[model samples]
Target: MEWLVSGLIFLHVTSGAVALVTFWLPLLLPKGKQAHRVTGRVFAISMIVCGVIAMVLASFHLTSPQWVEGAADTRLQLGWMMLYLGLLATVLVLFGLKTVRNKGRHHLYKTTWILFLHGALALLAAWVFWLGWSQRELLLIGVAFIAFLMVPGNLRFILRKPVAAPGKLRREWLYQHFTSMIGAGIAGYSAFLSFGAAMYMPTHAFNPYLWTIPTILGVSFMMWLSKRQPRYD
Candidate 1:
């Protein structure tokens, strides 16, 4: 079991590194170009791989003897956090991809599975918030709020119909795609930075200010990008 966990960690880290690098390429390259498409696909796949591995690792953590013994430790906290983040990343990336694929047909994107995913994440966010408050762990509290921030906008996008105006639907889908992808990037950066700090700078691992850096930078960039009308071709 230990060996299996170690192997999963290796794959998770490897795929996460690939995701981190490829995430920038699509944004930097000319949009709708073959290079951008290929790199974007790579980024999406890598993120999915990382997220799935994270959930599996979280399961291992949660089911460990310490947890079963009702021990409250960092490991247990991380298990919940990992589960939340993994699902969050997966949903954001898939949402972005689906928005692009179903552009101008918003109704088609509201499949049962997609709706279920959103609902599950929303419930998890609440549970995480409760856990954070009870444990007094600011990191988990903040992460829960981040998930909360996504829920309303996502629900709105999934349920609401686009206005009957020329180019409005296109713009809506375009913005949704960009927003979701950038949000996924934020999740990737947060996990990477947090893991790095925990491994190399343990003292700063739980620093409240350190955790906010990714959100701050990512949101600033996201806002800047939102102002521009990106070309699909």
Candidate 2:
């Protein structure tokens, strides 16, 4: 049971890592649609199972006993678990509701939003877990509140009519995004593996923000230099 739980967590992390690396590449590259969709299905299933099993095992986890005064502070693990649950619920809600009616405008916008939410939060959590940092609640709460404000701005950016044609936009930005995705994915997956492996006692799971020097540096470097923009605007 111990290995089984840990194995599932590991598999989940692996899938997430693979997906992240490939996430943008497929969109902007000449990948087969069928293959992409099939992989997406696999990722979705893996994530759901990971979420459910994590919740169930949270009870049996003897490392951090639930909410003590200050013996070891298991609440950090619980907080991450809750975040996991929230991510799971958000994905299910988005995938569950599908409609042909909201085609042109409403459908596109809603689907876009839900997909954005899922990807954003999932990737964000992945990055956080990878670093094994401190879970300062005040910072997280403030970030969350500000994040909501950024959502609409992001949506606008995605849904806006592009000045360039589809083909041109694809040509111009695909490689850059693909590069960044791979770099980001590596950093995030490393975090996931590290967290699961180190979940031994003072697991850095609850530290909210990631703090590992390597991961922190890797993420920073990737974000700063992942993609090279073409000189010709």
Candidate 3:
């Protein structure tokens, strides 16, 4: 039973890791249409499964409740849940619209959504920590908000036009997208593996925030390193 459970957890995390790289590499690196299409399919299917499985397993675990309430706090808890759910639905709608409106640019839209997962996951971590009232929960607060910032960054640089200068363009579009995407892929793998280990380890609970600090610094460093002046004709 122990080994079997561990294996399932490993599968779930491994899938998400592959999905992360496949999904984001194109966005960050921008290889070409062919590579983009192949990875996109891989990422989407993998993540959906990962999320579904994790959600189910979470039911059996003794994690903290979603909310705690005093009289006035009841509405706040409801609002919090509603806000996250509503944003999730809205993101889906917008991405769907982007797919339709920019049919030729499907990768752009999809990557944006996946990138948003950083914020979504981080924010969720924060909430879990807060509700659990665990001292360790405090760790993820900054990381979660930073994930939100990535939403705009991807939108401006990725979903929109290439911002790099023509002359300074050492690497091509697909390459840059690939780096970030692959970096994300690697990051996902690292985080997922970490999570899986935590999940089954029985020692410390799977604190999603475990990866938070590293993620924050890593993202900032990479973004700075990767920035370029737009190539103007």
Best by lDDT: 1
TM-score per prediction, in order, is 0.91, 0.42, 0.46
Segments in model 3 whose C-alpha atoms lie over 4 Å from true places: 1-14, 20-30, 62-126, 132-134, 151-187, 199-233
True lDDT of residue 206, candidate 3: 34
- lDDT of prediction 1: 0.81
- Encode model 3's per-residue lDDT on 1-233: one tens digit a residue: 45655675677667666665565554545434777656655665565555454443343232323322223332333233223322322333233234334433434554645557535644664574364353344323333343354345444444465444655542333323433333343334434544444436524433455555456555655566456522232
Pairs in steric clash, model 2: 130-191, 134-207, 135-207, 135-208
lDDT by residue for model 1 over 84-152, one digit each (tens)? Answer: 888888998998899879887867977998899989999998998898899887878877777787767
Best by TM-score: 1
Which ten residues in a row are the worst by lDDT in model 1? Answer: 65-74
lDDT of candidate 3? 0.44
Please give the distance, in angstroms, between residue 174's alpha carbon in candidate 2 and its true position after superposition. 2.4
lDDT for every model? 0.81, 0.42, 0.44
* lDDT score for residue 195 of model 3: 47
Comparing 1 with 2 on TM-score, the higher-scoring candidate is: 1
lDDT of 1 at 92: 89
